[model samples]
Target: MCGGHSRGHFGHHLPMGIPVSVPVEERRSSPVDVLNERLARGEITIEEYQRMRSVLDDQYRTKHSPHIRKPTTA
Candidate 1:
């Protein structure tokens, strides 16, 4: 009974299927646009906007090149 159960479980262990394509929706607003809007509405200070923009820029760059670090020598 144990052997039969093991054989049943091990059958067809390899995955079989064609990959399905999924559509990804693009963001409606760019990071720059979102930051500008927040600044215009007084929701963020100039310093906050600058910081957020820098952070977002770094994030975008890192996303595109995760293995590469930003230059620190200046």
Candidate 2:
């Protein structure tokens, strides 16, 4: 049993058999959060974390800022 539920029942069905619905934000971890977790777990070095974080930040800004246009391929 896990989390007080039988192994077979764990995460399978609710009391009325209704499927669990999670919000989009709750369902997925943000890229930055994942990166931070990786850093905390020693999976990435500080330098790598900084470089990847910068890339993620740039992508977020480019996607959210209307004034910033993406480069077009010829």
Candidate 3:
């Protein structure tokens, strides 16, 4: 068991047949979100931001639509 129960592995119960310790709210920011923030901060041009966003959206749809998984390195 994990979470609010016995520490099965690193103080988290195994669910989805995987060992996860971090809470959902503690996860890192998404790439798109980070890029958006940069755009808001005037660190990147809208053209560049939109291009990266399109690429990220494609990868997200391919790999993260049915099942949620960690972000890819590529």
lDDT of 3 by residue, 1-74 (tens): 43357564453433667765679678798898899889999999999999999999888777867576557798
Worst 10 residues of 3 by lDDT: 6-15
For candidate 3, what is the TM-score? 0.49
Give one digit per residue, the lDDT tens place, for model 1 in 1-74.
Answer: 46345656643444668444455455477879989999999999999999999999899989999999987997
For candidate 2, write residues 21-62 as lDDT tens digits: 788767888899899999999999999999999999889988
Query: Runs in model 3 with CA error above 4 Å?
Result: 1-27, 65-74
lDDT of 1: 0.81
Model 3 lDDT, residue 72, Cα: 78
Q: Backbone collision count in every prediction?
A: 0, 0, 2
Better of 2 and 3 by TM-score: 2
By TM-score rank, best first, the candidates go 2, 1, 3
Q: In candidate 2, residue 38 scores what lDDT?
A: 100
Best by lDDT: 2
lDDT of 2 at 29: 89
- For model 1 the local lDDT of residue 24 reads 43
lDDT of 1 at 21: 42
